[model samples]
Structures are given as structure tokens and as C-alpha cells.
Target: MARDYAARCPVYPVRNAWLVAVAVLLAAQEIGAPKVQVAEELEAYPTESVELSCQFNDGGGLTKLTQVSWIWEPSDGHRDNIAVYHPVYGQSFPNVAFKDRVVFLHNSLENPSIRISNLRMSDAGRYTCEYATYPTGNEQGTTTLIMLSKPKNSANGVTVQAGTKSVVVARCEAADAKPAATIEWLAPVGGNHSTSTTSGPDGTVTVRSEYRLVPTPADNGREVICRVNQKTQKQPWVYPIKLSVEYLPSVSIEGYDHNWYVGRSDATLVCLANANPEPTTITWTAASGPLPETVVVEGNKLTVRKVDDAVNTTFICEVKNRLGSSRHQITTVVIEALEDPSSAGVVAGAVIGSLLALLLVVALIAVLLTRSRRQQRRGYPSSGDSIATGSGGSNGGDYGNKARLLFSNSGNNSSKNGTGTNNNGPIYTYREGCDATGTLTEKANDYHHHHLHHASTGNAPTAHDILLSSEMDEAERRKFDLDDSMEEEEERYDRFGGVAGGGNILPPAYHVHRGHAGEEMDVYLDDDMESQRDGSVISRTAIYV
Candidate 1:
């Protein structure tokens, strides 16, 4: 085996060795690699600062921690170093422009992150984070930077009267930022300034600026303004302001009172006038009357200490300013004293007494008329009986026999015996008398047979006997009959029949008779009568006297 140690050359073998080298290269490319990616592509509000971080994964075992750096390459092609960190030597270096403003935020072998602060418009550019190992050489991650600008407010303009203060406000807003902004105010020359800040719902910030100023007379034609500031950029933003002022006079006055009563001791009135420039003077005049010497006038008020009985009086107050004059007036009235209560009361009482007397007279007349009517009604007499004298002349008499018989029958049984006048003015007399006839007929039927008798004179008749014959059957007779002889004598003259004599005459000589033999009588008459044949009859037979 030692003797054959000679070399053998073959082309296929060389070709196979070339293929193996190519395969090794492909495997290295697939197994270990450096990759770059960005977490956030965009940002806002540079005042809050920003960070760009680079990370490595699955690094082929060549981790010797060679190099890591951050750079800014502007759109204009200018490049500047930001930060460089090396594990072996700690922090290698940092750019002078960003020495204290940039930060390296990593301590491990995996991360290379950088932070920049106090950003300005010039710093906005493309930034790259690069990392390298001993064998892998280098890998980089990139991001774009944009500097935020502060929000600006619109111009504001306002005008105010001279010596008067006015307020003006302006607002500006910016949103979705890392940090909030501030607000400020700017006023015109010789004006005032103020400011305030607030946050919004979407992480935005708002600035409110306010301005106030008391304009001078010279500033009447000028202007003033308000402005807002959001400090997102380097330069402070500005807003314009315009202001105007006006001037005029003001007048005020006071007097004793709006409503004044007459007879005041002394009235004082005053007038006051003020303006940007004080007024010159004030004067007062009477609008319609010669002002009383008692009137006192002051700066703005006038007083009349004593007032006389003036029917019409007026006071005018006038004030003068540099530009013009103004005047006002008040009027008053006076009258005589009021009447006393005593006199007024006397007049009123007299009126009431006169009315009462008139009413009394009217009532008296009505009563007299009513009484006269009643008396006339009662003066008429009822027809019943009359009487005739021996001379054969008729006379008016009282109630006739029929009426007397009814009274006589009722009186016989009545417990009370008296003389009384009926509503018709007829006098009735009642007394006890005998009804001797033992008649079997009803009382109503027996009334027809009974004869009533009235006195020929005023004297009532005495009791008399009523006899019937024993031969007659007393029980069978309907009523007792008066002896025909006695009745015949009583009716001797036809003058007493009907109402000829007794029925219509008042009784002076004749009176009512009752209780004579069971009879009673009522007397009624209208006037004295001599005979019943001579009186006038209107509706019925009249008694004549």
C-alpha cells in the first residue's frame, strides 16, 4: 500500500466540488439574515419628541457587537450623525447639534433605539437606524420626520366709546398630538392683553386670547385685536389688531320728587352733566313762571324751600357741554283748602231729612183714602124690617122678624149673653126665653112658623107667656103657634111689614130684643127715619121716614 502513493486527477470530482461550494453559499443565505422594519410610519407635534428603534432577530452566530449608529439624511441629500453605541467601548459618539437633545435608549445587544428632542423645522428629514456584527457587516431601518407648526388665529378688530372698556377674543386649535400647546394675547399699541388655554376631546389643545382696553378720545378712529399661540414650531406666531374709540357727553339730573304736592316748605332741584371733557356750566329757568326766590338750585338738583299758591308753575333745568346744551322741565299745581267735615255733614243730613218728610206725607194720604173707602162700604144698610107710627107714617126700622127669629132661636141655647156688632154693623142681643110648644117637627121645619118681633121703641120687650089650647094634640103639632089674637094686634098696621119701616132704620128709639119667650133680636140701620114710605130706593125697596 505504501508503494502506490501516487496522485489521481478526475474532472467529475472537480465539478462536484464546485457544486458543493454553491450549495454552501445558498444555505448560508437561507439560515442567518439581518432584517429591517418600521413600527410607526408617521408622528405629530415635535414639541413632544420622537423615538426610532431598530431590532435584530435570528442573527447568525457572528455576534461580536461590532457597530450601531443613527443618522439623519434630509430630502436635500445632506447627511448628519445622530448617535453611535458600541458594546465593547460603551457609547462611541454623538452629533454636536444633538449632544444633550438626543438619547440612546438601549443597554442590550438586541436593540438600537434613538430619541430626538427640541425639534425644529430644519431637523425634519429621513432618519436611519443601522446595526452591524463582526461577520454580518450591516443592516439599517429608516423613518421620516416632520416638524409640527403652531396653529394661528384670525385677525381681530374692535372699537369702543371714549373712556369705555371693551373685550375682544380670538381662538386657535390643533389636535392628536403628543403634547398640548399654549395661548397668548396681543393688543394694539397702547392697548391691553390677556390669554387662556384648554384641551379638547380628541387630544387636541385650544388657545383663547382676550384683550381689553379703555379707549382714549384720540383713539376714536383706531382699532384693537386678540391673538392665540400654539407653540408647536420654533418661531412664535403673530396676529394683527385694530381698535376704535368713540366720545360723547352724558347728562343726569335729580329733583325734589317726580310727584310733588303743593304747600311744600322749600323745593330744591339739581341738574348734573358729565362728559369725556367736563362741561362748561349749568343754568336754570322757569318754563312758565317767575321762579320763586325760595327756590335753590344745585349741581344736579333744584329745591323750592317755600311754595306759594300758584295755579300753574314750571321749572326748567338746562346743562351745557362743549358741543351743545340740554334742558328738562317739571310742573306743579296748587288749589284752595278742603271743606270742614261739620259743614259737609250738616248738608247731607238736611237732604236725608227732607226725603223722609216727603215719604211720611205720602203714607198719611194713602191711609186716609183707605179709611174713607171702608166707612162708605159700612154705611149701607140691609133690608129686613120697618115700623109705622100712629100717624100712619112709615119709619125705617132695624132687622125684620125673620132675622130676629133666627137670632132669638140661637140665643136661647147659647151659653153667652151679650150685645155685639157683626162685620155688617148689626147689633145683636141674646137672652133666655121659653120655646113652650112641644112640637114634633124638625127644628129647621119649625123655623118657618115662628114669628120674630122687634120693639116699637128702643126698650126691649119683657118676657111674655106663650099659651096653646089643651084640646090640641101637642105632640102631633109641628110647632107652637103664637095666639092669633096677640099676633093680630102686633101686625095691626101694614107699615111695619117687609122693609118698609124697621128694616132700614138705625135704632135710637128701638133696640134689639132677645130671650123673650125664646127669641132674640138684632138691630141694624143706616140713618134716622120718620117713615119708610119716603126714602129713596136704588137696588131694593128703600125705607122712608
Candidate 2:
């Protein structure tokens, strides 16, 4: 059956040979032959050592160990001896390709494992461990060796000017890996990517990837990352690169505050430019006329020594780079003055004056309030007919204290009638002794003697003496009151003209009574003065103590 299948399919000749060898090995095992044990697969890196293990299992006592040998079978169907072990001659490497690089760990045929040093990519293939038994037959096992290599990674970005078309922005490569490496790109921009693979003569693979995007000025300096992954690396390798996009110079002017006025100094304007290559030339010019003589020109800056009307015009700033040139303009206005220096002072002075006026008003109000309180305490009625009452002595005799009453009318009709029943206007009242609460008291009798002396001289009390009595002594007060009363009485008498004016008038009513004390008399009087329409009058009445 094997021969028939081999004849039908000529492409499977190597498979037929493997099947025949397997059948022979199985037949030998059934007849109690030795079994050879070897690993099915192995892996190694360049410049490292590798071990190929082979062990003989003599399960059947009928077989005796003779020799053990290791062989290399490449993918091209060529076979060669790697190392051999014999009980009589020890170990020996017969293949010139593995001469000094291969050695057996044991000289005995029971266990023969060979160690190969300084491994190369070409050494990766199938290794066969064969055992020669004395009585049964030869048995063998094969192990496949695989070689791995770490790849070299690199990445770079291409410098480009802004454009509308999509183009390559960055490239990443992983070169010379045992197995082909996979590459991916990471970027902040939206774009597309492509990957390609290449193979070298030494069985190493290389992978490359490219990122493409529409170039723009805003995309410049953006980071693009390349990630490479391979079998030999524990983790993926990363490389970051920045994209470079060039463009023309963009120009702008700054530092104009509109407050540029006459006599202003240190006013300046700066020209700012953005470009890939640095700007080489910066210029300042006047758009309407020649620059003012007070203007100072520096690189990218224009300073005014002193602002004037001549500086009120359009100014232009031109910037130039390798790409092109750009210009920006600014219009300036020169005013006669920035602000009035005294205006702040005027406002502050007004505020201070208002505050002072407020304080003065408060002080005046306080003074008026104090005067009103004093008047109230002195028993001066705020509104009523002017009324004066005398006090009696301690022993019910004459108190000997007197008061003078005066009335003045400025209009034809007095504000109040003599009966004290009219309410047309305010009136006045006075009492000799009063308490702090505005209640009249009888304490005036105690000082009646002091007052009587001034009254005996035919003097009358004045409004000033009554109002300011707290500030004067009793005698001083009496003297002022008496002098003021006599003058006022004379003025009133002349103004009234009671009999000289030829008008019928009634005499004042008087009542006199004897006192309990020796030669003491108590007297009471009521006086009234009235005039016709369109007349003015003044009246005074004196009371002796």
C-alpha cells in the first residue's frame, strides 16, 4: 500500500521515507528494542548555547546498548552527523559544521545529550537522536530547533509645508527580526496608515509603517508614536516623533491703548510674527505720511519720544521670512490731553466739603436741641399766653419777689387776645422756680429777699435774664434784669401812647390785701392793652416786691 501510494503521488516521496522509518521503529519496539526519548521542539537566540537531550530507555532486558549518535537534518533533505558517543571511544563530532561547537554531556549510551555553543541562524533545523542496540535495532527521535532575533526599531517625521493634499507625515520601521514584526502608529491627528514587509537572505524579516495626513500649520509639532511588537521582545518597543509643518509669516501689531495724547512718553508698538523659519527682517512705516521725528524705530518695535499731533496716523508693520512677507496696520489717535489732573482733586474736595457740612449741620441740630431742653426745664411753656405768677412767703406773708411783664404787638391784630383764649399762634410763659422735668416748684420763696432788692428799685425782668439765668449770680442777674426791664418799659410806654393818642382806654385792675405779718401787703394786678385796626402797641407793667 505504501509503494502504491508513493507511485500515485510523486510529490510525497519524503513522506513515504518517513513512514517506512516509523514502521521499522515500531516493529523494533514490538520486539523489545530500546526506546529513544528527545524533545519535540526547542528555541534559542543568537550567540547563546542550546542543549539537545536524548535518553535510551532499555525497558526490554533482551537489548544491550551499543552506541548513541546525534544527526542534523536540514529542510533541504540533507543529513549530517553532529556528535557520536561510543562506549569504547568516548564522544566524537564527525560533522565539520559542528566540529568544536558540539559536545556530549555523557559518554554512555544510556543518556546522551549534546550542548551546542555559539548558535547561528543557519543551525535551526531538525536534530535526530539515534540509539544503536546490540540485539534489537536502531531507534531514533527528532527535535525541531527555532531561532529568534530582536528587531531594531526606528522612526522619523518628515518636514512639510501646509497643503490641501494628504501626504506622508511620519514613518516607522522594525528591521531584521527572526519573524516579521508588526508595526502600528499612534497620533492625535486623524489620518490613515499603511504597512509593508520585507525579507532578508538570512531569514530575517523587516516591517515598516507610514502615517499620512493633511498638513496644516496647527498640526506642526504634533507627536506621532510608533509601536513595534515581535516574538523575541517581552514588551512592544515605542518611538515618538514630532511633525514639522512650515508656513508663511503671520504678522500683528500690539501696544496701542487709544490714550496716546500730547506730551506722552514711552509709548511703543511691537510687531509680532509667527513663522516656521524665524523672521529675518522687521520694518515700521507710516501709512499716511512720514514717521514723526519724535518716533524711535527699533527692530520689531516703535517707541515715541513724545506723542504729538503728527503721530496721529495709520502705522504699518511688515515682517519678512524665507517663505514670504506679511504686514499689519494700526490707526492711532492723538488727543490734546489724557485727563484733567485737577479733576480728581476737585471730586475729593467736594466729598470732604460734604462731610464737613454734614458735621456742622449735626452740631447745629445738637445745639438747638440742648437749648430747647433747657427752656423746657425752666418751665417756659412752648405755646400759650405769656403768664407770670408770684410766690408766697414761708409764713403766708409777702414773699417780696417781683416780676415785670411786657407785651409787644407788631400787627394791627395781636396774635392772641388778652383773655388768653385765642389759638391763632404760639404763646410764651415763665415761672420763677421749676424742676428738671418742667414742673413748677415753690422754691422761689427761699430766694425772695435777694430778688426783692432789685424789684424795689422799680426794675423789671428781661427775656435774656430768664433764659440765661444759670450762667449768672443772683445779684448780677437782678441788675441785668432791672436795667433791661426799665429800658423796655420806657420804649413800650412811648409806643402805646395810652392817653397821649386820645383814645378811650380802661385803667388796669389792681387788688390789695393786708398781710398777716407787720406792715406787709399782698397785691395783684391785671393789665390789658388793645388797639383798633392798623395800629401797633407796646405795654409794660412793673410789680414791686
lDDT of 2 by residue, 1-545 (tens): 99999899777688889999999998877666437888999999888999998887766567787888898987677999888888898888889989899988877787899899999878888999998887767889999999887898999998888889999999999998998899988888998899999987667898889999999988988899999989889999999989998888889999999889787888999999998877889989998778989999989889999889889999999988888888999999998984665587998899999999999999999998898656444323232212222321111222122232232222333233232212111112212222211112222232234445534553333444343545334753553444645544322222212232344333342212222222333232222343433233223232211
What is the alpha-carbon lDDT for the whole of candidate 1?
0.49
- Per-residue CA lDDT of model 1 for 223-289, tens digit only, reads 4433333455555555545454434545555654543445545555666665544567777778766
> Number of clashing residue pairs in every model?
55, 0
Which residue pairs overlap in candidate 2's backbone?
Answer: none
Model 1: residues with Cα > 4 Å off, grouped in runs: 1-34, 41-50, 57-65, 73-78, 116-126, 132-138, 145-159, 162-293, 296-306, 309-314, 317-545
Candidate models: Cα lDDT each: 0.49, 0.68
Candidate No. with top TM-score: 2
